[model samples]
Target: MERPRYESPVERAIREAQERGEFDNLPGAGKPLDLGDTSDPMWWVRRLAEREQLDFTGALPPAVALRKEAATFPESLTALRTEESVRAVLEDYNLRVRRDRLRPPDPRMPQLLAPTVDVENLLARWRELRAAAGPPLAEPSAPEPRRRRRWFRRR
Candidate 1:
């Protein structure tokens, strides 16, 4: 078989870029690919989501939003100030999920977002997360003395 008489435009551009070192020192320059020869249907979507640091669920329907929050409740607990806050967030999420479920079956509902949350379990996880994180840092007991007199102070 004879080689193609002309290289594709994409091939020509890539060759030129390689000559100019444009592809050198890229993010994974010396690293091996994390992928395998096997393929995944959503590979590109997952990769784009990772590179953009985006929540893939954000683009999902409201049903998914409630479910994702319930599923990742432990992660959210770290940012919450108190057990009350965790409960509040979970309660709100539960309420939303119930409300969404109340609606008659429709095309609007997301296929994969069925939330069967256990408030008790969520609360327990929150407690475990708090314990694992250790006690909160102690705040200063008093404000420090003024380092210097204010220029605008009356003489």
Candidate 2:
């Protein structure tokens, strides 16, 4: 990575270009390039997401995604329809967490990002969310019983 005392062809071309003012007044002139996380294999992908300001968590493994979702459990519960739906979602989430726990950890990657969820706490949060969502749909009222002949009415 040393600069040559004698001009190499690549250096000669660069020098010629500089003489022609090709590198002058360039965008971000004199600024360091953001060669971020060069050691990471997915550096470019990470850079793209950072540049675009995207929510990249969903792109992570199910365990990681579930952990993130669990962090915002109450907010997430609002999207579900019923208590049963919430339970089902948690069951699926827990199953994935268990699977991740059982799997051998990768040397290159960090440990499983999944966290265990207490069903009761999750359900309590679900109930709170459902209550905050306003009243549930009610069934129709029962029909009133028909009355027999009364004194005020004709027999």
Which candidate number would show the highest TM-score if scored against the true structure?
2
**Candidate 2 residue lDDT tens string, 69-125:** 778876777777778888888888788888878888888987766787888788997
- The window of 10 residues in a row where model 2 has the poorest summed lDDT is 56-65
| Estimated TM-score for each candidate | 0.51, 0.53
The alpha-carbon deviation from the true structure for residue 8 of candidate 2, after best TM-score superposition, in angstroms, is 26
Q: For candidate 1, lDDT tens digit of each residue in 70-131?
A: 66767867887677877887777778887877876666644544576777888898788878
Among all windows of 10 consecutive residues in model 1, the one with the lowest summed lDDT is 105-114
Over 4 Å off, model 1: 1-56, 108-113, 139-155
